[model samples]
Target: MERGEKIVKRIDTAKEAKQNPSYFEALVELLFQLADDDFIISFRGSEWLGLAPHIEEDVALSSITQNTMGHASLYYHLLEDLDIGNADKLAHERQAVERRNASYFERKNGEGSYLQEPYYDWALTVVRQFLFETMKKVKLETIINSSYQPLADIANKVLMEQPYHLAHWRMWLKQLLGSTEEAQNKVQFQLEAAWPACADIIGLGPKAFELEKHHLIAGEDYLRKQWLKELEQSLSLPSSLFVDNHPARGRYGEHTADLDQALSTLSEVYNSDQKAVW
Candidate 1:
């Protein structure tokens, strides 16, 4: 699996992947990215369980959030098979510095708790979900031909349900942008705030070169171009909205206070009884 060499063989199991150190390392890193991204964003989605803009939206988002969390679990299970750690501990016990999710996904919904005066922002939710699902769709499609057969299988399974998820968010974004001036302004503001923080989301982390060299996934440039092309054609969003200038690089393990808060909240129940069989 050297640079520029075609991946002639498919790794059918984690044991086969572990035979090659380079391939195994890159595969683990890529898995963490996939798992962490979905895990954190799904938690954010759950924060809106009963607080969505309307009753219909509340139900829709809850369903979508559950699906996303299940997707995360699938990826984490793959890691567990690789002997990295238990999927539960990997998801719940890892610290912010150990997380590989993009910092943007970990940002608070708004300036309040979900149980108390939950002043969540629907516009921000719309923008973030649209962007994230679009990226997820592109990434999963690209990895459908992954050198790791197990990962490719999971990608195919995920794609079966992911399109509906993307459509759900796209509909929200379109309706928001098409509504009155106030709605349009809120969406625009969120886009501006999100643009600068999304660079890490599209990245494959510090082992990116290895991931590409091993044919575990496509190059970052290809993924970014495809993502941008999809957003531009579908949403008519400006290319400038895709700029990469964020200071925190979650792919490199750099995160924010938002992630610290999110980790605490998400892990509370698991931490309560580490040996509990859920």
Candidate 2:
């Protein structure tokens, strides 16, 4: 054993987290990012619910939306255990600038409202979800081995339902890409749009060094490599994929106005008289 070396202890429960303030804060921070990302993307999914091209796909995709929101709730509850706040309040009450989700998850679905004058594109939906699920697979794989025991357990539970989501989107993308030239081009265009945005998805936020230093999670470099390996094997990358181009990195509290609109819609019911029983 080397002199002056410190041993990192595993956090087996919420009480252990509080005993180590740094560990608690890091766990809470990472959980906030995970919860917020899932919440926003699932909200986008709900927006596309009735507007899908095919009835069967619409129904199937709706299930995924429900599952995503469920995952968000799981993460939010972990934060609740940390004394951050109740899960519902954490999910619905936070201002946009306080969110820690990647900006990639908050982008608008398309040109108009889901209920009227709709111009939704299935290609973007498929690309976005597939890409996110792939990245999520990598993230969860690392988090399953996290020092925080509760989070590791949550990752195991999440992985059970998450693979179906990845597979569904993967199937959509391959079929669309293998179809007509028009379909291929449409899908390809959306792929390019998301390519540069992968930076935000791969990042561990401003506290990357600290998170890795504490053995809370793998370093951003390791996570990115894992994600890129999966991505390259599945979908051929555009040149832009390598660029660290993020319009806004939400992990650092930067968010677009799109997030403002989304928060308004998703929390409308909950925010209406915060005490009413539904």
Give the alpha-carbon lDDT of every model: 0.89, 0.86
Q: Compared to the true structure, candidate 1 yields what TM-score?
A: 0.95
- What shift in Å separates residue 40 of candidate 1 from its native position after superposition? 0.3
Q: How much is the lDDT of residue 218 in candidate 2?
A: 84
Pick out the ten consecutive residues of candidate 1 with the lowest summed lDDT.
233-242
Tens-place lDDT per residue, model 2, 168-239, is 988898899899999999999998888888888878787787688777778888988898888876688766
lDDT of 1 by residue, 25-59 (tens): 99999999999999999999999987888899889
Q: Give the distance in Å from residue 19's predicted Cα in candidate 2 to where it truly belongs.
A: 2.1
Q: What is the lDDT of candidate 2?
A: 0.86
Cα deviation of 217, candidate 2, in Å: 1.9
The candidate scoring highest on lDDT is: 1
Colliding residue pairs in candidate 1: none
